[model samples]
Target: MNAAPADQIRLLDVQAFDVRLQQLAHRRKSLPEHTEIQSLTKDLTQMRDLLVAAQTEESDCAREQTKAEQDVDQVRTRAARDQQRLDSGAVTSPKDLAGLQHEITSLAKRQGDLEDVVLEVMERRESAQERVAELTERVSSVQAKADDAVARRDAACEELDGEAASVAKEREVVAGVVPADLIALYDKLRAQQGGIGAAKLYQRTCQGCRQELAITELAEIRSAAPDTVVRCENCRRILVRTSESGL
Candidate 1:
């Protein structure tokens, strides 16, 4: 189809804007912040898991400590009752008294052992609580980082979107200059030619296909009218000639 030489050249502007828009879109999706966000999200998940485990351990340890302390209390209460009975001279039989005294000694040893168990459990519980606290703090720290990463990722995307909006507006203006039929052709070719509908004929090569045209084809293109829309014999994309086309 015949379009003004200047109009055909304007099609290149549309192509340029479209390509820039594509690049901007790609940049928005492939930002480094996107990768950072993914990594931060993964860390947040792992950190939460660790915190949960720590909380479970602390709770279990606390229960064990309570039971241990109760065990020690029960042993001490029994020992106290035995001591009181021995002091009151309740067991008047000499053999019974001797047995009561021996029973008191054994109760004292048992109380000591239970107290030792309570101390060990308390220490373990305390350590588990400390671990929970540490993990909680770490989770908060990593959560803050993840939030920052999300903010950064969002901001970067917004900036790219804003730029793309501006480029799109420019593309609309550039596209308005070309005739409807030419745009239809360009759109069709763009769909078929990997998003490149037209390319500059730089030197002797068709930039769209990056191939040099045969001399016979070059001669025909040179001989064609200035208003003619030349297509590459190799790629069939509209070849927009320029001063550098070496026609």
Candidate 2:
């Protein structure tokens, strides 16, 4: 394949732009906000789970307290009824009256036990409520951090995308002036050679491979026509000659 000397130089400009676009893409991926967002998202998930668990516990405790208070009320009502019956002489027989008084005493003790249960349930419910509140706040805090990180990542990516778009446009303009056959060859070689299809021959060295051309190779290049397209033997890339080629 052959291209004019000026066309080969323009190919280098296209390569430079391609390299810049690649760097921009790398910067976009490597932004710190990406990792920050990931870590924060994990923490947010865990916090939300804890908040849900705490809310469930609080709800359970509330139901338990209500049931305990109801039991206390029932026991107290029974004890009051039993005392009234004894006081009104409803049980005149000595044995019956004594039995009635004993029954009242047992009812009083039962009411006291039920009241204690209500108090215990109240304490537990209060603790559960506090835990739910704390977890809720923590979840909100973590969620806020995650949102901020995502915003930062988006902003950085937008900036990089803008720059990459501009560089791509410049590459297109530069490549448009080159012959289609030459561009096709460059693209093929670029795909095969790690992003570098053409390189400058400077001071007797192939910049693509960083190797000095042997005496015979230099002799051959020196004898080649000025408009001839030459390739480096070491790296198999198009070698564009310049005044600094030391040939």
* Top candidate (TM-score): 2
How many steric overlaps are in each model, in order? 0, 0
TM-score of each: 0.90, 0.91
- The digit string of per-residue lDDT tens for model 1 on 43-148 reads 8899889888878888888888888888878888888988899889887999988988898899888888988887887788788788889888988998898889
Q: So what's the TM-score on candidate 2?
A: 0.91
User: What are the clashing pairs of model 1?
Assistant: none
Per-residue lDDT tens digits for candidate 2, residues 1-247, read 6778899899889889988988898899899998998899889888888888889888998898888888888878887888888888877999998898888889888888888888888888898899998988888888888888898899889999999999999999999999998888888888899888889999999998899999999999999997788999998898999998999
Report the error of model 2 at residue 73, Å: 2.2
User: Lowest summed lDDT over 10 consecutive residues: which window, candidate 2?
Assistant: 70-79
Worst 10 residues of 1 by lDDT: 119-128
The residue ranges of model 2 lying beyond 4 angstroms of the native Cα positions read: none
Q: In candidate 2, how many clashes are counted?
A: 0
